[model samples]
Target chain A: MSGTRGERFHVGTRKGIFTVAKVGGAWQVVEAGHVGDNVPIVMHDPRDDTLYAALDHGHFGGKLHRRPAGGGDWEEIGVPTYPDLPEGVEEDTDASGRVIPWTLKLVWSLVPGLDDQPGRLWCGTLPGGLFRSDDRGDTWELVRGLWDHPDRKEWMGGGADWPGVHSIAVHPTDGDRLTVGVSCGGIWVTEDGGASWACRADGMRAEFMPPDRAGDPRIQDPHCLVQCVGAPDRFWVQHHNAIYRSVDDCASWQEVEGEPTHFGFAVSVHPEDPETAWFVPAIKDEHRVPQDAHLVVSRTRDGGETFDVLRNGLPQEHAYDLVLRHAMDLHGDGRCLAFGSTTGNVFVSEDQGDSWTCVSTHLPPVYCVRWEGRASAG
Target chain B: MPRVAFTPNLQRHVACPPRDVEGATVREALDAVFAGNPKARGYVLEDDGALRKHMNVFVDGRPVRDRVTLGDAVSPGGEIYVMQALSGG
Candidate 1:
């Protein structure tokens, strides 16, 4: 699969979800939907080739839709919903004393379950709620273990208005094992299929937290968490302020420094190479533009020991593209990669991070990109 | 029975034409309207059954006072308008 070609993909932008395909050696947006709406997340289920798009209509609220495997009309599906705030619980507050309303703010992460669990789907949402759907998003129920954890109450938002679980990684072999990355809530792992959870973020530091609480795993934000499919024990995270790599199934982490900058949002691991991964670094904080007004993707071929800033086909002059956490994705072949930026530019690389091709320059602000994988589009 | 009609803007996402239903309050009227049009329910109200902050409901040209419970009284022959606030965008 590593030698395969880049074919079709989807980019979820601030305005719509576009279906981009490589037809006759050229990339084009073959189809587009929700043309003037906010689509924050999209998922291409390789198991069934099903495409799910989460459209957050600012006024009408968050909505989810999907096209079945063989590709059909877009059908509206149920969004992850939170149960009613229990009666008499008017003051549902987090540790920071902020009222965390029981509402569906936005769909941050939508992932399909392991191969064995075909009908199962996992969803993460803002205000920090993890949900499970057994019917391909037709219905959903909130998972209580992670939401009810005592430490979750202490989880506060980092760069967002509310704490959210944005990244969810399901174990390739163990369907019961799952890991989730919260914006400011650290990393939580569950081996009992969401029945219970444990915080495994030990060495990740948070410069934004107080000196005494800087190492608190419950509040140390890991912006994105990705596990190496080839080496399941290896994991990498683009933390809020630093980059860390874990080689023990997230049991511990070691800080890895970036060259131009150490802060960024997106990270992608090679399909079968634990020593290879890519990241998009930014200036961090108040100014989120690319470092030195140059957009580049950094690649680590030796498991974080060293990195090469690849910018052959990327913009290097006065470019302000911030690749979001969910905006970058790699095809199963690893050589075929793509990532979109907050500026609405979509770039693809057929030869890994060696070079890139700009697919679109004027779409909505890209929120997520899902590359077509090994599975057939059917 | 009161008549419930969604703002025209909603038709683009979900079709919710005017419907006549028996109800004494805004919540009941909406509940009756959503009974047959389940797809439009999430577009109008939140999961907890509260009216969306950006969506306003009016009964006979008056905005409902109780947004949470939608308990504002609705006259038997009153006309209900579910309008998306202009500022909501």
Candidate 2:
């Protein structure tokens, strides 16, 4: 009864379907429909057999769904809605005396659970901060302190419509310890499973500052996050203006040393090693240079401290084309990574971003990539 | 062969070097170039096989609505153009 086939990988495109392609091969339609926006996909542990797709509705609202690694139907996990509010109170308050935001927004990283709870799921959202579900897609509860802290409002950027949590990083061994990246607010950490929260942006640059204050300016936009899965203390972040890292668990951060490209959106960490990470860098000032001259993917082995351009089989003397952040990722094996450019070309690398080959063309501005494994192998 | 030059309206964002398609009518020319790039077909034609509401296919500067107008009589060297109709914010 073993149907395990060749090494396979799946990528979700905004075209509303998950395209599965053989490793270093062509893409074929596997699953279609909104697999969720800004969705994060994770393969089941130990075997990487089963896969879970956490559809982050993000600004538009999101849901979680599960499917076999080999591909089949989607089983939607219930998105928590406002459980009826107290009759005498305001319309917004739930029965538990909590105010439900306009919509349930989710743009999160999927954190696998530990111990007896083999199916625990953790995710962060825009309107709902952070949430954890013990039973597979059964129910969910908000992680208490991440966004409910007294200073949460002060930390969230002035422009943020809601205090949103975009990235989630749980300690690989100690599931209770976790880190959350808030788009406009900054980064927050929880040692006792979100029972409390604290700002960890002390060394990170704050992209936005008071009009009168002068600063490095890059800190104003720490938009995306990549947690070193193998190195919990380190992190590689992609901000709107610059790249940064924290070697000591959000305690402090330093800029990725190099000639900066000035703009980028995504970050992909090496699957087996935490120190190696990759990012898409667009040339400085030239809004059209395809991310640093010729669609080059930057690699850093010693965390974000240093980086080098990974270009061997890539095009030379080409038009400036940049890759989007959420548009790229590293499959679990750590040897391959797939990225889609704003130009609608899907590029894959079998040698860990060292080189790439265009696998597909004419994809509608790819937004995210996830891995789905063997359907029955699970 | 009738040649058509596909120029993007939002030239600042779309950097596709002008595409030339040859055919007896608008449909034939577009079909050849878009077969491999199916994701681009939505922006060019509507569900009814009519030109998209926001796009204009010009027969040498004059807009043509009939997608099947093969007798519109395009000469061998005549230049046809496909331009995105611009709109306001």
Candidate 3:
């Protein structure tokens, strides 16, 4: 193996499952599912060290299954549904009076329960809204306030899908306090679990729209927002125009100075340190151009106050690129990180994003990356 | 009239072979270049057949957002290169 060795690793695409390989401290896996095309989301459970995958289950439907640490049984978790369908919306009506089935797949924003809430799963769906399970993946319930907010419809942008919640962050210490980012909706926070919620939209602005037009009214156009526990009150937002840092839990923010003033998505933070973070920058505001520049990875050692380009071992130019958020991630150990790109390539860095090596060359546009540490060989 | 060249990255996926397109409209010139190749659609158009967001068609190194009637008139010998915008962390 030329890349890093993996004790345990998993790769998820729209298709199905892939058992990733550990080579030279890098993770790479052959596109394991039937080819053609499909969307897949992959996540790892820290509680039992299990990996759960939500296959393409596109639009309104799909399946949820779990794979063990070493890779064996992929047990089905449960049937996914629109747990919090807005009240007045009629269930599918028919001559049989049976609610017309609306198939939906769980585009989950996963979080493992803390304290005694083991195996607890928190997920958001495509039609938009949140779900929580306390029974170790056996059952689920919708977190009420979040789904029924007075601005729900407005927050969802009147699109066929509600604001798809993709990123969920639960404070490792405070299970009750949490924050989540809706794909098209700005950002929302819950101070006491899901009992009560508030839009943390101070310095945050809508990405798809303009400034004077930014606010809850335009909540449906948020770009991507993520919080770094390393800086409890701080958040990094890759809005439509520039990258912003909010120091007051998103209540307020100041754009971080950088090269990405026009476009990019997928922002991540070092698991242990707040000062360090990574994001994939893309070219083309609206269409895919063959002339994309280098796939650059920017680093901020002082908590996103400033950023420096990391190019030591990366392709200097003609990278043929695009790096997505789920495409890039920091492992349990902050020093090691991995990222996939639209160019069908994967890169790994043992000394952070400072240096890189191509692990795999031709995997379908890698949408997400998930890893598990291989138990150290005695 | 001006001309632009495709980078190596673009060359890998496209068979355009780096050449000048002759037409009065951006769409016409692109149609001529992509004549034999049909796989470059999604990379250029959205699911609805509209130009994808964040995409640009440059004439002589300058960026152009318009896809319907690219403002940069394709003079007899002008060249255009399609590019995906680069922005992000």
Candidate 4:
């Protein structure tokens, strides 16, 4: 499952976006764009072959930029704006007790629409706003159903003053069915486009809350959510407290038992096989380093029935890096998997999870990694 | 007309050459500049139209008085410098 020479991966980093391509049996840094800006997500829209980079300028707020398929200058597409608050709804309160208005702080996730709707794009933002664009990236409208949900008031922040929507999984077969994972807000599914959304965090626990409220749905925290393309109903979630697999279109979830550590950030599902998945386990939330200071990727081929740790070419000692939720990705039949860490390490595995190679290490802290390749070739 | 210039550090990210725009107040001068380069507005101001926490604007080498409304008065031929605040480590 070696990658084709010239296959490219767009990596979002703390400093900018770096283009890494496989060239002559080695991965090379082809280009470094958006220098000095914090890039959180880099997505390749298969419908039109457009590359989108979600830039989080610490001072100016977050913005989205797109470049053509082959190569071209990046164009700034406007970031989504949350609509005015409904009457009588109080603004979010910051740690200092100051009232903070709903603002677009960062673009955490970008998901392209189904094949039937090629021009459509879905974006999830900080402060828990879901936006959709029908004209590619021209104009955006906030999905009011999720923004105005009554449970939103209880959805507090995890690392910031407000909760953020970081993972979005659009059903491969049904465009109308989508699932979004929010930090400290649990899992939400929408079956009627943007008209309605319901919580689907059953069986998920939130240990950060009080003992009596640990199992409450409104307090569940999911770090990442990925769906199997071959089986749209099958979904995998790497939660802050544990890992879960949902087989019924995310209507219900059950824990994926017997993992080295239940705490992790990223999750990748096999493109063709719903039974295969990968996760990078850490010590825990407070101590977010590799377990025992040894980095390893855990894989389950039997749909969470059994687990095996892969550390052939990875660091086995004193590696204190944490992979972000969107920093790991699997492309083209799930055989080519790439993941980046907060310490600016990029690792790739062409033979699924058997072996690994460090692609780049001198770049800025990696935020997200995405692969762009043809499905049939792999 | 007041001449507006951006710090070199800010210009490295976004091209903002010195330009003269007709305006009576700091807000009007910034609005004139935003008319030509809308992207720069986000770098300097927040969604609520307040100057960003990490940004500062000076009129004729003096800090602007009004940050929320940006209502500082500007004289003809005055210089406005928009630069990143030197506060964070």
Highest-scoring model, TM-score: 1
Off by over 4 Å in 1: A1-4, A374-378, B1-89
Runs of candidate 4 exceeding 4 Å displacement = A1-6, A87-100, A374-378, B1-89
Give Cα-based local distance difference scores for all models. Answer: 0.84, 0.58, 0.59, 0.81
Off by over 4 Å in 2: A1-6, A23-48, A54-61, A82-102, A155-163, A211-220, A258-262, A283-293, A313-322, A372-378, B1-89
Candidate 4, after superposition: displacement of residue A235 in Å? 1.1
- Candidate number with the higher TM-score (2 or 4): 4
Q: If scored against the real structure, what TM-score would every candidate get? A: 0.79, 0.66, 0.70, 0.77
Task: Choose 1 or 2, whichever is better by TM-score.
Answer: 1
The CAPRI-style docking tier of model 1 reads incorrect
| Chain A TM-score, structure 2 | 0.79
Across A210-284, the per-residue lDDT of candidate 1 in tens digits comes to 344558898777888898887888999999778899999999999998867888889999878888989999986
If you assessed candidate 4 against the hidden native complex, which CAPRI class would it receive?
incorrect
Q: Which scores better on TM-score, 3 or 4?
A: 4
State the DockQ of every prediction: 0.01, 0.01, 0.03, 0.01
Q: DockQ of candidate 4?
A: 0.01
Task: Give the C-alpha miss distance for residue A132 in model 1, angstroms.
Answer: 0.4
* Candidate 2 per-residue C-alpha lDDT over A1-378 given as tens digits, one digit per residue, 9 for 90 to 100: 112332444455554545656533554444455543544443333333445665654455566676654556768766644233346745442221223463555444555565545667676665536778777656877665654465543433212334456667667678788777765556778888779877776555542232221132212346677776666787878764467787788787677753346457778786557788887777532253654256677888876666788777666566445565456766666766777765556777778777777766665556566543311122
Query: Candidate 3: where is the Cα deviation over 4 Å?
Result: A1-8, A23-39, A58-60, A83-106, A157-162, A217-222, A260-262, A288-292, A373-378, B1-89
| Candidates ranked by lDDT | 1, 4, 3, 2
